[model samples]
Target chain A: MCFYIVINDILKGLKNQEHKYIAQAISIVENNSSLNKNLLLNLKTSSMESIKIGITGPPGAGKSSITNQLIKKYRFEDKSVCALLVDPSSPFTKGAVLGDRIRMRDFYNDSKVFIRSIASRGSKGGLAENIDYISDIVEFSGFDVIIYETVGVGQVELDVVDSVDTTIVVLVPESGDDIQVMKAGLIEIADIYVINKYDRKDSDKLFLTLTNMLQLADKDKWIPKIVKTVAINDIGIDSLKDELAIHRKHLIKSNKGLDKYNDRFIKKIKHRLISDFENSFWNKKRYEFLNSEIEKDINDRLDIDSIINKIKSI
Target chain B: MCFYIVINDILKGLKNQEHKYIAQAISIVENNSSLNKNLLLNLKTSSMESIKIGITGPPGAGKSSITNQLIKKYRFEDKSVCALLVDPSSPFTKGAVLGDRIRMRDFYNDSKVFIRSIASRGSKGGLAENIDYISDIVEFSGFDVIIYETVGVGQVELDVVDSVDTTIVVLVPESGDDIQVMKAGLIEIADIYVINKYDRKDSDKLFLTLTNMLQLADKDKWIPKIVKTVAINDIGIDSLKDELAIHRKHLIKSNKGLDKYNDRFIKKIKHRLISDFENSFWNKKRYEFLNSEIEKDINDRLDIDSIINKIKSI
Candidate 1:
């Protein structure tokens, strides 16, 4: 099959809201196949007014349960939703089990809730290189809400959250101490903070600490709200849903909605261009040259600056 | 002053073991000054054999306290030690408090122990772009032991740890659940795991879990040792130090010592080249061009791929 035909079929499938084609297209892009560039080039910006939300927190913070709750809430509204779990694969240990999917099995049989796990490929970037493209594909695939769930509170997950319109940082009472929270800088990035597993004895204290810290931090606008939830029991899910709605309305009314869309669009383009440059510039020949040079006497070779300049001139 | 003269003075002062010159050289590189390229090009790799240790874990894992103990241990041996704390600057708040330094006040007045904090600069990579060069500067400045302390167990910290000869992952009993440790992928990167604040009730349980996990993971030759410590009171510091020595000896006996050195050397070169490419490629003009293009209609202008190809071809 020619690349064009496959892409066209995928596009048709996407337009028709076919989940199979959506999955295939995502796979093609994630693998960085030859046709992936063409796929992105041919893709138009998603015209659908979809809400993109990023959920991030420390590992074992019930991020999966919170996401499951969000998925159920959206599905109950009769809205189609897609969730992308960005799993960070370890560079040394290749086996990274996406156990979060087991918790999300309820949505597996529901056609309205499409869930996909994307490995980070253990790249320097916490995200896969094709993440933006994949998100765009999902956005244009007729979903009303696209939720991105990242496992850890690393820079990679933070970058993913930054690219989304709304970001929710989930934390458990035992996740860390209040000082640890401040030191990790988690208090700054959250548009909304979720204190999951609120049944813990220390939950109220942590909540109060976070609220006080937020007050002291002096966030100019849109003070982040802390919501308590026992996600497994489906408690507090409605309040969380209402908070999301409130945030959405705030964004739209404050003219930040258009600004955020533009910011994400520009960021997507910059990331794509950088990725393309890296792919084209660092080919097999370049790697061989770099490896060989690295093995030689340092004084015998051209400095890194000169080599970069020469490459640019070429 | 001319760049050559300034660099020459700094080099002379560094050779004289002047602490002021070492700090100045680090600053010049950290800022990515125009003189940095020339400085790196002229500086040769360190000839003195030194131990590079990376200590990383989740925030508030008593990393600073552990580091302080290590520094004291090394200084007690009449060996000069330098510590680098890689702080992650928050993108939203832009306020990264160097609170770790306050804990190292005892070493501040001591000539044998030098402490420096490097900000992550909120770049995609966790380590700053010039971290390699800065480490090189510290290395040639005659420090016997160089310890890198990172605030979080993110990929940036992982990369930093990978470039070092020995990596110690510090954890507290309250850090997280066992699943969280596996999910964070911290199990694979530790040459030695330290359970700090060992007096906690679950510390013994966590230690057993880690040891079992290491066994199941099948580490080929060197088995990672789990040590317990109350770093604040200096309890178990000697045992931890002995484990570090044991790992160092194992690396030497297995002939991985040379391999690790070569790996770090190659990594340094690759990082420098990439940093150079990013600096030279993403100039003011390129930023303006990208920003302008991002504002245009998608179909009305060249796609990101074409733009990259055009830039490269130019």
Candidate 2:
């Protein structure tokens, strides 16, 4: 499985910036390579030329609708757009695939647009872990920008996927799990919260509640913006885009993203390492340790402390 | 953490269970005492007499309720019953809270009943990695039988919790995520699944689904009995008790519990080893190997095969 990285090396050997960027990324992802590692590291040190935007919302929250509108607007200007859709992993857990694709059926065959849907396979970091790598691939593949669409709510999903320069969380009237949003952590993580389906009468009440919650929170110069949109009719998308651009501009000016990306990258690596060990970790060293620990007898025999230490130190 | 274990002499002090039978098994779970470890080497080998029942289900499944019922029933018989609740934890992400205590309001006042909620606290095993030591704290306190209640549903929880003689999965109908029972591995591990809230219309449907799913699996000989109960009303309490006892009789006759306990003990220790190593091994070890591979620029850095090997080997 590891030897497939040869394809990636071959691509590097035949290096040409004009090559289809998507193909290059596909090779890297499919073929495990030394080059792939370098590519990831390079991305970490690179720039904000291709501004990434994240469009995410829970089930029935109009995230895809907003993303579709953004794609259309980008298309109208003759700009290349890439939309990456992340489907809920447990197909039965949540019905987030509520016609997200069929709704944008008209643009299915659009040559200027690159649409890709990734099914999260229960990886703990959710879709977030793959986002940066995939984003690099999409951006280098000739797309001016990429829009990452995420399922509204996921244990590990919400934060991990394509971390855009700007993150927009789509919400709706009568949003369930209000307490969840108000929770200190969730509220702090969200940069922008969009109240989609705003044309409805109940939107005002929801807006008021959310506002109250925000006002009550302790803010030290970080105030997540609330944008209202009726995505179905293509309303408020331009302002939303403008807001996203402004946020990106803010990030670059403050250099906040530099530290944030570094921290996230390190965290991602740690998460992946832990996941790898937990899932497998059992060829020989494990068995050797297991034998010694057992010979000690669990109740009093095994020096669990020492055994655990040996494993950790390994 | 390793030093803390030996400095306290926690292992030797807890293994003073020579005279009492239940004390031995209680020590196994409480301290998570490693069997292979030599603590039991000095003592005479003898079997313990205690009813150890494991209670499990998905996140919202009414396991606490069933456990509470069992405690009440055993109390009615004038038997000392200890309730051990396993709480999940991982400080790196969202640390799960201990919530069953509030739900178990009435059990607190009973002198004959001892209910202690066990939090993993980022411990290697979500179960007491120290095992017998912790269960010793509960058992040497002199409770005749112990009921282990676990939260949510997952392979780890089932495997760790099912060391008990009888495994019971308490479930509810009209669940938002009942389908998880199908997608997840619960259908196999559960020895008996109690459909709590039996008055709901979906109970019969859930039962049929479970039956159909199990029948299709290869474990044709291990037919897990399905019991329906309304824990709130204490309906079918006698029947549930009868089923549990019958299952116990069958297990003793078949000598399955002993094998299960021993097998589970080994696997439990290994799981702890993997988790502990995973927590720190990335920056701890992988960077050197991965960096060297990338530095040498090995085209086929041999990732997948190495990943499989690295994980297995670690």
Candidate 3:
């Protein structure tokens, strides 16, 4: 296919809310194909704004269930919702055991809800390079909300949280000891904390602990609210949705909404520039020369600092 | 103190296996102090070979218990063991919890064992940059085995595993569904797999599932062995040790032992060079100028690609 024709067809389908085009565009962006550059170039004219929510927490925290509940709630409100499930696991085995899809099977038939799973592909950046592009395309495709659901509370998930406007950190009663919660740095990134499986024993205690910890930490402009939910039973979904709406209001009222969006743009640009610099800085010839030099100098007793300095000088 | 004097003192203490000096040197390195360069320079001539093993898994997997058991087993053989527990968790709560220390309390008074907990400090690398330097210092200080324990199965942990001679992925029977293990990419990285909490009912099922998965995957040079352990009760520690030893023997027999160490050195050097380039590329003035430009251009409708291209041209 001609590059322009492919780009225009994808754009037209996206603008018309065609699910097939959205999926095709996401795949192209995820793989970072040549067509994606043209697609992104065309997407620059899109000014549509979408609410980006990041859902992250420790593993087995019922994130997928909560996301499913949120999707149903949003769809019932006559809003279009798109979900990008970011699995930081290996790309090789992702297809064989896609647990997230199984958890979110209810959305498979919903035309108003678009869902996609992204595997990390072993990038150091926890997120793929074109996540911003994908999100932009989805927003332009007329989704009211874009949800990024990541599986763990690692640095990669934290980076994903940074890219979103409002981050919802999901936790369960048996998540871990208090120390584990604090260690994961979950307290820092949470704009709203959801204590899922609220009927479980010790849920109340965990909730209190989190509330107390939030109090002890230096207060941010918007105090994080903890919502209790039994997502499997569809309990407290309304309150959770209301809390998300209130948080959005707070961001706008405090005039931080634009700042948050602008920050994401800046981050995207910086990442692109750095990636370009890295690609240009290390040509194939230079890389092979450096590799050979490193192998030859392995037994030379040269310290790493000196070796780096020598490479830089060269 | 003068830089040379401080470096000499630390180096002398490390050479003598003075626990205080080892701890102090690790602190200096973890903090990335100026004197660390001198210390690394002085230690490059020391050529002691210490077996480096990386142990990684999800939270609540009893990693420390298994590590404690390994310490006991190694100590029983009259070999000194040094463990660096890399907690990619927050540095803020690290001092407060020190949970791993509590879990491995048996090693506190054992002169043959030294344990240090490293908090990530939000560095881009899930590990502190000085982990290699600390490992080298400890190896030169006469430790027979060095163990790297990281909390989560994130990319940072994967990078750490790549630098080690052998990797053991620890898991529990209730570590979520079969999908969680596959999602963790744990299957691909394991030189040896330890199913801790073997007393659990579903452990046999998980074991069989893992065995079957391994059978389906492409064969590697060494078939990964699964060891069942009730780490708290000290079960299966000997077999795990034997498997690690056998893996080490395989590496030697395949003539990849030195190659592994050399690869680690090359990685360290490359990381240092990249970090240096980043630091030099983004000076304070340039950073401020770029930030201002981004903030200005964010609302100007200029796409990220053009901005990056312009920056590159400049």
lDDT for each candidate structure: 0.73, 0.58, 0.73
| Residue-wise C-alpha lDDT for candidate 1, range B65-112, written one tens digit per residue | 899999999998999988887765564223334456667888878877
Alpha carbon RMSD to native, model 2: 9.0
lDDT of 2 by residue, B1-314 (tens): 66445523533443432223333434444453444233432222212356777886644445667888888888888888878766543331132223456667787677667666554322333343433344434444445677887654433343345456778877777432333354333455677878898898888888887777557656535578888899878887778888888887777777665556456455545655654475455453666655454443224345333443564355
lDDT of 1: 0.73
For model 1 the interface RMSD, in Å, equals 3.8
Residue A126, model 2, lDDT? 33
TM-score of chain A of each: 0.89, 0.73, 0.90
Docking class of 2: incorrect
Find the 10 residues in a row with the least total lDDT in model 1 chain A: A91-100
Which portions of model 2 show Cα errors greater than 4 Å?
A1-6, A9-218, A221-258, A268-314, B1-64, B77-100, B111-172, B176-194, B221-225, B236-314
Q: Is the docking of candidate 3 incorrect, acceptable, medium or high quality?
A: acceptable
DockQ of 3: 0.36
By lDDT, the candidates rank as 3, 1, 2
Instruction: Identify the leading candidate in terms of DockQ.
Output: 1
Instruction: Give, for candidate 3 chain A, the lowest lDDT window spanning 10 residues.
Output: A39-48
Off by over 4 Å in 1: A91-98, A122-128, A174-178, A216-220, A282-289, A297-314, B91-98, B122-128, B174-176, B218-221, B272-289, B296-303, B306-314
